[model samples]
Target: MKITQKDVEYIAHLARLEVDESLVDKFADQISRILQYIDKLKDADISGAGLMAGASLQNNVFREDTVKVSPGPDVTLANAPERHEDFYTVPRVVG
Candidate 1:
């Protein structure tokens, strides 16, 4: 888990970043400390904890199926510039 200056340079290279030479040591130290903190989490007890399916409590998320009336062609095609019966007409294009 110890992050070296070389490791920082390698990470920067993988990310295609131009990391300044002066900040390499600083970044290495910061990353090493963060990894050390995360390593300490391995000792945490979780034997009594329940297995979580998800964070949300509610499971039944579906809505009830119901019939609805349509607005019909007249109201639907009212905004069209050119309408034939119940449809909007567009200019045909040839390739």
Candidate 2:
């Protein structure tokens, strides 16, 4: 996990960045430490752990479905500011 100045320079070139020459060594050292920390995480033990779950419920649980009839567009759009041809109209939102 040891990063060199050359590696930093190459990464900067690939990213189209204008890294200062004086900061290359600093970046290499910081990257090396970060990679070493990540490498250490690979050794974590989790044999007894289960998949992530909710605090109060288990996975794959669902409620019963119910059916209902729609109240029509008149009731749905009653409070709209503007309407045309069974649809609501608003000012252009995007440029």
Candidate 3:
């Protein structure tokens, strides 16, 4: 679980991080512990377990896609301060 200053520097370079020289030792220790934890996880057994994409067992849970009547064009146009034909018109954003 021991990590060196050189390892920290290398990791920082790979990550494109501007790490402080003083914090290199601390960063190295933290990274080393993370690697050690991963190494420990590799020793555990999970051979027969099914692969799970998410926590819940529910799949394709959705409401039926059906068209329902909302407000008509006239009712929608009434809410708009300005409208052209059946659509709301706004100031041009770009030429």
Among all candidates shown, the one with the greatest lDDT: 1
- For model 1, how does the per-residue alpha-carbon lDDT over 66-90 read when each residue is reduced to its tens digit? 8889898998888999988888888
Q: Least accurate stretch of 10 residues (summed lDDT) in model 2?
A: 51-60
TM-score each candidate: 0.45, 0.44, 0.46
Q: Candidate 2: deviation at residue 83, Å?
A: 39
lDDT of 3 by residue, 1-95 (tens): 77888988987899998789889989888888888888887777989987888999688789989999988999878888888999899999999
Count of backbone collisions in candidate 2: 0
CA lDDT, every prediction? 0.91, 0.88, 0.87
Error of 1 at 69 (Å): 27
Q: Which stretches of candidate 1 lie over 4 Å from their true place?
A: 46-95
| Model 3 root-mean-square deviation | 10.5
Please give the RMSD to the true structure for each candidate, in Å.
12.3, 10.5, 10.5
Residue pairs that clash (backbone atoms under 3 angstroms), model 3 = none
